[model samples]
Target: MNHEKLITLPCQYPEEAKNSFKKLIFEEAYLLFIVLGTGETVNKILDLATKAAGSNQDPGMVIWITDYTVVSDIIESLNDPLNKLNDLDNTYAFALSIIDKVVDVIKKDENKLDILRIWKSFQLALKG
Candidate 1:
C-alpha cells in the first residue's frame, strides 16, 4: 500500500477507502480462521474477535497487522460512526460477509463441506 500517498489524499477518496476496507475485512477473517482453528470454542472466538476489532481507544490486531497509521486515517476519513471497522459488531459482520462470499464461490464445488464448516463456526461465534 502507498502509505504516504493514501495519507495525503483527501477524504473524498471513497474508492481507496472502500478498497482498503475490503482488504482489511478479508485479512481479518483469514487471520481469525488461522488463529482460531477448528478446535476453538465459540466463546473463545467471540473474545478474540472483540479484541481484534479494537475500538476508538485500543488498536486491534487488524490495525496493527495492516499499517496502523494508514488504517486509522482511513477509518477517520470514512466518518461513518455506525459502520466503523473497529467496532466488534462490524467485525462480526465483516466475517459473515467473507463467509458468504466463500460459500458463493464454492457453492457447487468440492469445497462445499468447507463452506459448511465455516458457516457453522460463524454461526456459533455469532450466537455467543
Candidate 2:
C-alpha cells in the first residue's frame, strides 16, 4: 500500500478535519473488510454494502475506534500475493468513485453552501 500517499491525501484540510476524515475512512474500510470477509456471493455483498451505506449510522462505529493492528491486517490482506481479497479493494475504489460523482453533483447545485455546512457539522460531530 502507498502509505505516503494515504497519509498525505488529507493534508490540504485543517488538522481536525483531516483527523476526522481519516477516522471515517478507516471505519468504512474496516466495515468493508468485515462485509467482504463474510465470503458471501457478489450480489449479497452488494446488497449489504448498500444497506450499510444507507443506514442511519454505521454499525461499525459501535466499536468507537479501530486498532492499529486491525488496520495493518487489512492492508496486509489487500497486499496479499494470492489476490484473495481483491474484491475489497475494487469495491472500495468503486464506492469512492460514486461518492466523488455525488459530491460533484452537489458542488454544482445552488444549495451547495448549505449542504457543505451540514457536512462540516457532521464531520465535527464525528471528530468528537
Model 2: how far is 46 from its true place, Å? 1.6
Model 2 alpha-carbon drift over 4 Å, by segment: 1-40, 52-54, 61-74, 77-128
Per-residue lDDT of candidate 1, residues 29-64 (tens digit): 432221211222433333444444434342222211
TM-scores for all predictions? 0.22, 0.21
Model 1 lowest lDDT segment of ten:
100-109
RMSD of each: 15.0, 16.3
Among all windows of ten consecutive residues in candidate 2, which has the lowest summed lDDT?
97-106
Q: Per-residue alpha-carbon lDDT of model 2 for 1-128, expressed as tens digits?
A: 21111222222344544455445554443222122122224334333334333243442211111222234343342323333333333321112211111111111122333324333322332332
- lDDT, each prediction: 0.32, 0.29
Cα deviation of 56, candidate 2, in Å: 1.8
Q: State in Å the error of residue 2, model 1.
A: 25
Q: Pick the candidate with the highest TM-score.
A: 1
